[model samples]
Target: MASPNMQIARNARTRVADRVTSKVTDALKSDTAFESGSLALSARIAGAAAEAVLELPAEARRTLTRRQAELVRGVRRLVETFGDERGRRKIELIVPETVERSVGEGLGPIVPEEEGKHLLNELAVARKIEDWAGTVAGASELNRDYGIPRSTLHRWQHANEVIGLLKGTKKHVFPVEQFIDGRPALGISAVIGLAGSHRTAWLWLRQANPVLGGRRPIDLLKQDRIEEVIETAQAYFDPQ
Candidate 1:
């Protein structure tokens, strides 16, 4: 066998040759140049560029590799979190449902003014739902952690005001920190009642409250200060 240095030199030559050939072929196909004799000049320029790329700084290569790894991790998290029933439901919510309607029923091509309004409304709704879902734990994860049936949790979504509605999936998702020791945290339902939606309630619960000495309302609720937290939530929605 040839020595390692010889093998490396051979491989480098092969790569340079490939780049040059490809560039020349592309130039001819485009027919941008009048003379086919310019192929050699184009090939040489392409080969030089390829060699410069191969000689890029080690730090540049490391940065590129790190960025690629981070991108892969981000995509994986998105798939795991939103690629389930919830994601599908969210898609449905954003996409307007087609209902068979007569021209008299205000069902036809959307006018310019109405189209913009409709799009904005859908975007606002999608953002609210996505924000809530991001803060909550999905049914599958909660069920696995607490041995609660998915079906039962879903029923609670309708029965309890503390459950937030998600657009994409039919699954019921609750705030990840809403439960402690497999039991609902105190004051969640009361706050939900005052705030009208779980998203609004969650925002209030998470924010610092003056009455609680600048501590998050959720922290106070976890400490069994249900009445105080509920009062804070009320004040949050309606201040005297």
Candidate 2:
């Protein structure tokens, strides 16, 4: 077996080789990457220049000059805010989701307006729900802390007895409040069935309902007001 440092080096090389391969493929596929004199895509492209060929996220591809400028400004703000730490080789910078979206939307061909508006709307809604719901934990955390088995939790998720939100790219997180006495809170399945999705159910449950006199649906369920909660949810979905 290789030494740890040797293994690290090998992994680094593998990652670099993969990135180069991806860049080459992007060059071949991108119409904008064709050079005036160079017939070979591989000959003219490498590093940052080659990255220009990679396709942007669908919502980000239509960014105009103004959008690109927003990204530049965001990065500049980060650098200025951390100017004292600039001497360090690397430092992580955290920014709001809107600024993050600008970074992705800053590239690619300028298209018609409002291309990134949908992404912004989605980000805003996610932020609101996450803020209200709060303190989500993964399956392993719940198993370790609450003594609820992962298999049981997964089963509950499948049954819609529990609410699981896709916290990031792929990791699903359940709100701590979803579990009661090591089991899913009562009436969650009913709400999920009515709402049509776990996320929609959870968001609806957490939000203040006008029919329920500004009381959240989840609070009503906790108080054993299942019938009333279900009726309110029905009214919300129907609204006719």
Candidate 3:
């Protein structure tokens, strides 16, 4: 019943609508790929949808109506997920301002100013002990002063390299007798002797002390002072 030109126009409009709808459906489906272990798929789908919108015919583009807005949003989401270098630039643009706002707002808890000064004094004392020649005393003093558990101090003394570094000068000597008497103990040498290689010693050290950041015991042996190595070996053997 419609004129030929009218029929042609109707068909064109339907085709454009169908194409836009299909693209949106495809974008939605592709978005799920992010949850499916394919990180790149979502980006690709979003890029394609954006391109399709730009390439739409003039008449189709003009008739975009509400559909154009939806397509643009979809493209933006996709770009957010996986846009090229330019997209990353856009994302990072506001980060500095956001950080500034958070700082200005004082986002965290508000303690009394005097309480902060008192905490600093307590921290300085603990730090002084850690820097002294006697690590056990330093650890014990910190434990007592801060009400930190003895077990936690021991765990930190044995497991954390940063704690080790803080406990004494890098050049400080460790006496064999100290190890024998079970003063500063580690069992690296004994474990190595049992396991029959420096490699296994390293593996055990990493497993027992996750804070060492996967460093090998042998590597520690090479870097640490001979006395420190002996002390660490003794502690590992006799961690009581």
Candidate 4:
């Protein structure tokens, strides 16, 4: 009953409505994808920044270079703006500064005075290594600090035994001698609680070892030899 022209006009209107709806749906999907991607990227960047900060000496953290502080602040801002508050809370639970300081202090005294000094010097070298490897330090630094040559350091770094040992524990374990104030006491549970990462804890244990000439904590753990952990804990918990 309608005229040909009216039918044509009605068809045109329907097409326009369909196109608008499709476009709106596509736009919403695109926006959601962009938001998710941005959050993920921010999280990765924040995590890396945190790791770098943790590796630095406590004194260095206090006196952070302008650039270093800026980077940390930037990451913090991104995390605050984009990260889910719940997720951020979880990260805080994992790696609190108090735990890091406790582990560092606990491990400090046990390091041979010479080796401890060498590790400090190595931090500068680590800066350069990061440029080449995307990390602040490498096995070479550890090797150099302990007077072990590069090849030996490389071998131990890749050894499965080392990796296993590093993963055996859930917390970072440092010797009492390493304690910042040379405190003679601390509990294993306390040490474990302080160390947020199993690997960091393992590294602390390995560093405290007098043997292996400074092999990584992972390698030591893989070997089923935790004499140092035992000895350190005993010394701390058992005062004559």
| Candidate 4, residue 90: how far the Cα is off, in Å | 56
Candidate 4 wrongly placed segments (more than 4 Å): 1-200, 206-208, 211-217, 233-240
Residue 127 accuracy (lDDT) in model 1: 56
At residue 107, give the lDDT of candidate 1. Answer: 66
Error of 2 at 194 (Å): 1.8
Question: What TM-score does each of the candidates earn?
Answer: 0.44, 0.47, 0.16, 0.17
Q: What ranking of all candidate models by TM-score puts the best one first? A: 2, 1, 4, 3
- On residues 96-129, what C-alpha lDDT tens digit does candidate 2 reach at each position? 6674333455567765558677656777733544
What are the clash counts of all predictions, listed in order?
A: 7, 0, 11, 17
Q: Which 10 consecutive residues of model 4 have the lowest summed lDDT?
A: 176-185
TM-score of 1: 0.44
lDDT of 4 by residue, 123-186 (tens): 8543332232222223444344445455553453343212212212452122212222212122
Instruction: Provide the overall lDDT of each model, using Cα atoms, as 2-decimal numbers.
Output: 0.66, 0.71, 0.46, 0.42
Residue 186 accuracy (lDDT) in model 4: 26
Worst 10 residues of 1 by lDDT: 64-73
TM-score of 2: 0.47
State which candidate has the highest TM-score. 2
